[model samples]
Target: MIETQDLRKEFRDGRTTKVAVDGLTLAIPPGRVTGLLGLNGAGKTTTIKILATLLRPTSGTVRVDELDPLRDPKAVRHRINLIAGGERMVYARMTGRENLWYFGQLYDVPRAVLGPRIDELLALVGLTGAAGTVVERYSRGMAQRLSIARGLINDPAYLLLDEPTLGLDAPIARDLRRVVARLAAEGKGVLLTSHYLAEVEELCGHVYVIGDGRHLTEGSPAELTARTGGHRTVRVTVPGASPEVEAAVTAFAARAGTVAGLDRAGDGALVVSVSHPGEIAGPLTMAIVGAGGTLAGLEVTEPSLEDAILALNDAAWLVTA
Candidate 1:
């Protein structure tokens, strides 16, 4: 397990000091995909770097399988690998196959073992055909895939991914997610940092919400959303409703008085935004029916992970970690 307690990091410029990670506590256990979520300047990447032994913490304790990263940085590096989103990791001049082979060699894997491992990784990232092609020719998504392949070359016990799917197309991101799932299933602890909350909710067993380098809250995606008393949308569609139905909807909207506003969608659906859709949905459905309108569909859109996290960050409720 890789865990931290009250971890903090600060940078200094002359007399000014800026804290990058402030009192962050999180745990990533083997066979589980844990997510570290925050806005761009929220210090998520700083925390990941500390665990990967890239940056030394200013305070608190960090353990990678019970070994102190500061005390045994070399051992920590050997046991973990970080795949940052971008084209910086792979060698642009090298072929996709050569890049993996080179990283494998650096990790000191035997050529006999490394050769086949490279092929497996290339296939895993859908870069098998592009294996012989120089990385310069690979597209952005392909490069990101190659970067993922390189991170796995060492086959480390822990993997840290920073924005692994930042700019990739939907299909490419889906494929990378599968790779992440496979890694966890194989017993490697995966620590993921991403702005894509839906992806995090889908892949992570638990998530740590952070802001301004401080821990906001940590829980299963559902728990976090349940804790969030944010707004929910109850969409009521009355297909080809008479003007009487529209007037009824307008009156209901007046009575309900949602601060988020009730809207008429482009397709003529009535979108009612509220803090509690559960309390209003039944009456909302009845209003259309009482107006002599045929109800086409009624759907409730719950508070998503992104919504919950944003609410959590905005509230800044401090919880004991």
Candidate 2:
């Protein structure tokens, strides 16, 4: 398990001091994937670096498997692997097999054991056929595959993947996602940061949204969506609508826990907010007709994860304002 309490990190550049992470608290339990999401300069990388023990937090408590990172940097490092996308960490001059062997040696894996381990990792990453090929000859996807192999060479219990599928074609990205899922299934805690919200929604069991070096919200995708008011917008057009029909629809909306607003489509339409349009569409239509209003048209629009994130940011801005 990984846990952080009131984590904060700041950098100083001569006269300027920049806070990268501000009192961010989170946890990553074993056998699950946790997603860290944010725009540029949102402190995702900073938080990851601190957890990886590459950078020390200015103030906070960081523990990996009940071990403090600052007090036990080497031990903490041994339990975590940080795999960053768009990083050419492997030597282009060496074969894929050689690169893994080299990293295994760095981790002090015995040569007798390292050979078979390298073979296993190459096979695990589906790069066995290209194991003898030089990394310089490998494509971008192949290089990323090798990078993942390197990260696993140490057999760490925790993994940090930063944009693991960045700049990949659809099929390749899907394949990598499968690999990541397998890792999590193997009982490793995985912390993932990605620009692809769909990927996060598919893989992550829990997600954290951060903005301007602070955490905005954290929960399962469904919970965050509901919390951010990411509901379906249903527009019901009623021809020659009367005040009675409007009042009935308004009452229905309030009962459904949503606000009904008047639409100036010039067709006397009412825009209703709802978590699920199917749950209320038929009932609303029937109610309007019962009130002597003709249902001319209806439209339903569902919100996306992008919409949820934007709403979170907007709320954060309002709070800080």
Candidate 3:
């Protein structure tokens, strides 16, 4: 397991001091994927670097598998691997097979074991056929696959992926997600940082949202959405709707602590906002009907992960202010 307690990191530039991470605390246990999310300049990369023992924290505590990284940097490094996105970490002139073999050797894997491990990793990342191809000839996605394979050369127990699918096409990204899921299934503790909210929603069993280097919230996606006042917009088609029906719908929505907006479609449909749609759907339908309005159609749209994240950030700013 990897964990931190009140972790803090700062940078000094002559007369200016900048705090990159402020009292951040989180746990990444084995056999699951934990997502780290934040906006640009939010200290996400800095936090990852600190955890990897690439940079020492100014204060607070950090541990990997119960070993303090500061005092046991080499041991900690041996237990974890970081794959930073957009970085050309592979040797372009070497064959994909050679690159893996080189990294395996660097990690001190025995010659007898390194060969088979290289084969397995290439297959794991779907690069078995391209193993003999030079890294420079590989496409962006292929190089990324090789990068992942390189990171796993030592078969570390913990993996850190920063924007692993940053610039890939949808199909390529989906393939990478499958590899990530497979890694977790193999009992590796994975800490994934991505800007794709939908990707985080799909892959991460637990997510942590941070802003300005401080944690905003942490929970399962569903729990986070619920805590952020999960809402849905319900579009109700009510033809020939009278003023009484509109007033009654508006009043009901207000009582439920939701805002209501009405737009006259060519067919005269009313769109209503339901704060707690799962709980208010029935009542909303009844209210329109009970108010002497004929329902023509209804459509509901639920709050997305992006919406929940934004709400959390807004709440954090409100508190800080």
Tell me the whole-model lDDT of each prediction, alpha carbons only.
0.86, 0.86, 0.87
Candidate 2, residue 74: how far the Cα is off, in Å: 1.5
lDDT of 3: 0.87
Residue 13 in model 3: shift from native, Å?
1.8
Which structure among the candidates has the greatest TM-score? 1
Note each model's CA RMSD in angstroms.
Answer: 3.0, 4.8, 2.5
Model 2 pairs in collision: none
**For candidate 2, lDDT tens digit of each residue in 159-273?**
9988888777788789889888988999999999998998998899999999988988899987787777776767787767888988888887788777777654544465433
TM-score (all chains, Cα) for each model: 0.91, 0.81, 0.89
Best by lDDT: 3
Error of 1 at 188 (Å): 1.1
Candidate 2 Cα errors over 4 Å, as ranges: 233-280, 283-302
lDDT of 1 by residue, 1-321 (tens): 998999999999999999999988888999999999887789998898888888889999999899998888878888999999953699999999999988987888887889889989999999999999999998988998999999999899999999999889999999899989989999999999888899999999999988889888889998888887655777776666777777776677668765334567788765544445347778767887999888777777777999988888777645423
Q: Mind sharing the TM-score for model 1?
A: 0.91
Clashes of each: 0, 0, 0
Tens-digit lDDT track of model 3 for 1-321: 999999999999999999999999999999999999877877889999999888999999998999999899889988999888778689999999999988887788888999999999998888999999999999988898899899899889999998888877788789889988988988999999998989899989999888889988899888888888867777778888888888988998889877677778866566555556466777888999999988888788777788898888888778979
In model 3, how large is the Cα lDDT of residue 274? Answer: 54
